[model samples]
Target: MDGPSGSGKSSASRGVARALGLRYLDTGAMYRAITWWMIEQGVDLGDAATIAARSHEPVLTSGTDPDGPTIHVDGVDVGEPIRGSEVTAAVSVVAAVPEVRARLVAMQREIIGSGDIVVEGRDIGTVVAPAATVKVYLTASAEARAQRRTAELTGTTVEAQQAAMATRDTLDSTRKTDPLSMAVGAVELDTTALNLEEVIAAVLGLIKERT
Candidate 1:
């Protein structure tokens, strides 16, 4: 699965994974884990070279269970810390670094190679797993996306969340290294009016049709 933030990628991905008895990998959390590590080490986010140079220092481990997915950084579980506002604000910049993407993409591919898994991220279909059996590009209306994000995050209004998502969309889509895009054979699902179950069912239907 590949989509912008607040497009129900996480929820739908987890649902599909659980329903299909497949492992789930949230690639965004891996990026967030690295971003959290960089912030904890007091690395300057503005310096791309510095971020890239130190990107390999942290070891990231992802627990692929859809029901209880976890992420760890350097032996410490960071599932919550990586979701904080600080990490959220800087993850896009950190993820944009070429070295960072290269490192995490390698890790992602390794995990996918282990067995059947559902991976969700901005570039999974186009970069990480181009030949994935079923590629899906999910989307929603800007307003709906903002509302959903506001509900997930605390201390953020819908307006602010929407604005931040817009910035992230621009950054993720325009970044030079593995920019966000739909693969050639991807099915584009606009979830603007679909709830989580409906979205998951639609994706499952697509998988069935494709495979």
Candidate 2:
């Protein structure tokens, strides 16, 4: 799966994975894990070299289960912390580093080597798992994305959330490495007008037809 954040890629992928009896991997969480580590270590996220060097740090690990995946950094479960505004703001820079992609892609391949996987990220179908059984590129209008995000996070105004989501979309699309893009032959669906159940059902239907 590949798409901008808040486009229902995560939830849809999870639903499709469950329906297909495959594993679901959230690749954004991996980048967030590294970002959390960087923030904790006081590393300069803007410095690519520093972030690359720290990519080798034995600080990241993920649960093997597909039904409920977990991520740990530096022996601590920083899942919640990694999703905070601070980590979200800096993760794009950290994720842009080639070293980070190399390490994370290796881990991703290892995790899905012998099992079915419904991996969701900015570049999974295009770069990480080009041969995946099913490739889905979920999308939504910018306004819809912002609204969804605002609803998910409390105390966040709709305007502010919209602006932030726009910024992240730019960062995610223009990064030097594998920026957010739809894979060739990947099915692209605009979920801007669909409810969660409807989107899930659509993806499930796609998987059933494809694999």
Report the number of clashing residue pairs per model.
0, 0
Tens-digit lDDT track for model 2 on 45-151? 77899888878895677774556778998788877888798998888888889999999999988877866777889998889989877788999998899898888
**Alpha-carbon deviation at 119 in model 1, angstroms:** 0.3
Candidate RMSDs in Å, in order, are: 0.8, 1.3
Q: Cα lDDT of all candidates, in order?
A: 0.95, 0.85
lDDT of 1 by residue, 1-211 (tens): 9999999999999999999999999999999999999999999999999999999999899999999999998899999989999999999999999999999999999999955899999999899999899999999999999999999878889999999999999999999999998888999999999999999999999989998
The numbered model that scores best in TM-score is 1
RMSD of 1: 0.8
Candidate 2 lDDT trough over 10 residues, lowest sum = 58-67
Against the correct fold, how does model 2 do in TM-score?
A: 0.95
